[model samples]
Target: MAHALIRRTLHAAAAAVVAATGLVAAGATTATPARAAVTCGVLFDDFSYASASDPALAQRGWHIRTSAGGPGVPGATWSAGNVSFPTVDGQTVARLQATTNGTGAGTTHAEMSLPDRRFFEGTYFARIKFADTPVSGNDGDLVNQTFYTISPLRYAMDPIYSELDFSEYLPNGGWGATGPTNFQTTWYTYQPDPWVQDRQYSSQSRSIAGWRDVMATVSGGEVRYYIDGQLVGTHGGKFYPRQNMSIDFNQWFIDLTGHSGGTSVWHENVDYVFHAKKQVLTPAQATARVNAFRAAGTRHTDNVTADNSCTPAETPPPAGGTTRIASNWNNKCIDVPNWNFADRQRVHVWDCTDGTNQKWQFVDGTVRTENNKCLDVADAATHDGAAVQIYTCNGTAAQQFVLSAAGDLVNPQAGKCVDIAEWNPDNGAVLHLWTCVGGANQKWRRA
Candidate 1:
């Protein structure tokens, strides 16, 4: 996710405290430990590819972004040409090069992403070499070298959108700041046009000029960020990721303000990346795993699968009993707007009343209204923000829902929850299918 830089002086102090505590050396080499038993799925890649276009790369779910977009200098093309796999410091590494000639059209950014959005609640570790100065240009330019995970933002200030930026290293800072700052930001949601953001970030305003271990452990509802084995920040609450996200790495210019004269080129190098699904590993343990993989001559491994074994089964409500399903956010009932009985009419939250339109019964695996229309995922769509509407009762998975013990009303087909759009607390706010982030807007109860 793109972010406007905001200074947090407290984080600088926190970095100093961490440095004094001797948690771990910044660039120390980790010793290869004995092979450990793998209790869960894991992915480790050492970037041993011939080039960005290598067939093996695509087969392994890697994509070299060739799209044109924002999150960088406006009009700057994200070019596959800028991504390369080369030998650096005696090891094959994925290298991203971004160049600019002090003009939007003359700039090119590099990004590589995994197509799957199945990563959630895991330990993410990477060894990256950050450059404070351009590899072949005049000294100053505002560049962001990043490694992050993000789910699509369906709408402005989407309540269930998830992003965890493990690291965004700005060698020459942008967004109204000075040079050489690094940030670890956890996102809740944001608006792009007016630029309003709801997030928590920790930054260190010193040079992160060389290879460093950047790690994040997501567990027990908190995201803990570590650099070189020292704890840098811990963010939780609303910022906790509510869904799976793609793993990505990119190098781009925040803007051209710091760009000077002739074309300048910058580079970010990634030696390896590791992820342990549903497991929280310490920085030391993560590094040890990386080392062990290398020692065993395993250049890449991915045993991670989309495991939904924990999904709760549908439990029907009491026989012949009907109740009002109210949102935990505002105590408003799930209502068919205007008492509309037409099929495919979207549902919304409204003040609870004795109206039959607001009354619901859990029968079979579906939540049905007093009028017999079932709450369904529109057109059986599985994407985020799919409409939650009333449709003629049918035994499709789209109409099946499980009210999990945690209060989430989940559509088993989409694996999403019925969410009050945009976190709006007012009556008549529309509801839609969104990632189950356990947010108040996704929680419901029988009232």
Candidate 2:
């Protein structure tokens, strides 16, 4: 979301001007937009790291962000390319020769387990060809796209985090018949949310011989899965809101503690990957930046600021054309650029312009700066002269501000409307939460 640039003092000055002009307050803005503009791009692929460090593999969207806390191998590790992509029998097979070491679940890696963005309706497609041969003991190692599955160790993590699994069965070695292929799209949470799981399908006829295209599309909160471009199953509400995380891909072996002779089950022949695109890219010129890096085999350029192609901004403009004077007095709007200063210094408002620190968002019930700092009560006591300060955004009643239907900001906790913190008309003054007394201090109008 684009952050709004406006200093707290300027906001107060805007309010004061509204009161001076005798404009009626309208409380909060109505009509929150339903959809958001999304930024789409091509992430990296494994080929990007063919030249550099192993950690550089993460440039492709997968990460090893875990510290393995419990039992298994006690730490996180990335598997090197030991598995070969040779054709076994008449089919191509991809296998990983590495094992995991961590607490409980072997060695684990944290990946971009989920999408960082949310979508109300769109189709996600993945085409994969699997190995016909199932290793002796380790089956169920490879599963489809999952959310909370970012980390291998699942139990201790917060369940509120979401997860999705497509397939998770190992190759069957019994008989000469082809192993059964299974697919699923399920949501998992720490707290049992029954409505999350939607579909699962199993087929013996589906094997590693041919290309299988899997598609997932959501509409009206319902998810539909398509195989080979044909609708196969429908899952409704088994989904969660879209999140901003990266994608993860891994291949590992599992132990056969229960089976005879402990056959090491393995998955092989993994190659040819693609991610669905939401927007059609622009002319070749627009893709030049991406293509340049792609051609360089550089994988990615994370530190954009050093590229010398970026621009810097000057001091941010005042809020709503309202310039605020600074003051150390209490009970006033502090003039913080971006409202990220630790202490809520009182100040007055003035004119508007561009500035890095003027942006703000009223998150939950608290007014927070665009930089993610919070507007806070300097102390616990809710007296008339209580000081206001800037801190991190935490959902607290003290931080919960009541913007009147008329647009005036009110602090019900202090039972007062925000007034000049020190009652100073100078450049800076502390902004504080106070009772709503319907005075000029309590009046504010829209910018």
Candidate maximizing TM-score: 1
Per-prediction TM-score, please? 0.62, 0.38
The lDDT, on a scale of 0 to 1, for candidate 2 is 0.35
lDDT of 1 by residue, 229-262 (tens): 9999999998999877778898888788888799
Question: lDDT tens string, model 2, 1-447?
Answer: 011111111111111111111111123233431111111212223232332234544443233323222111224243443434455445333333433321223443222222222222333434445554444444433322111112121233234334333333234321122344444433423322221222223223355333555445544555555555556566555344232222333333222222333333434333322232232222222133233333434323211011111111111233223222222232223346444365554323433334434334533234556555656676544666676666654434455453444334544344345566444555444466554444454454433
Distance from true position, residue 231, model 1, in Å?
Answer: 0.3
lDDT of each: 0.77, 0.35
Model 1's TM-score against the true structure: 0.62
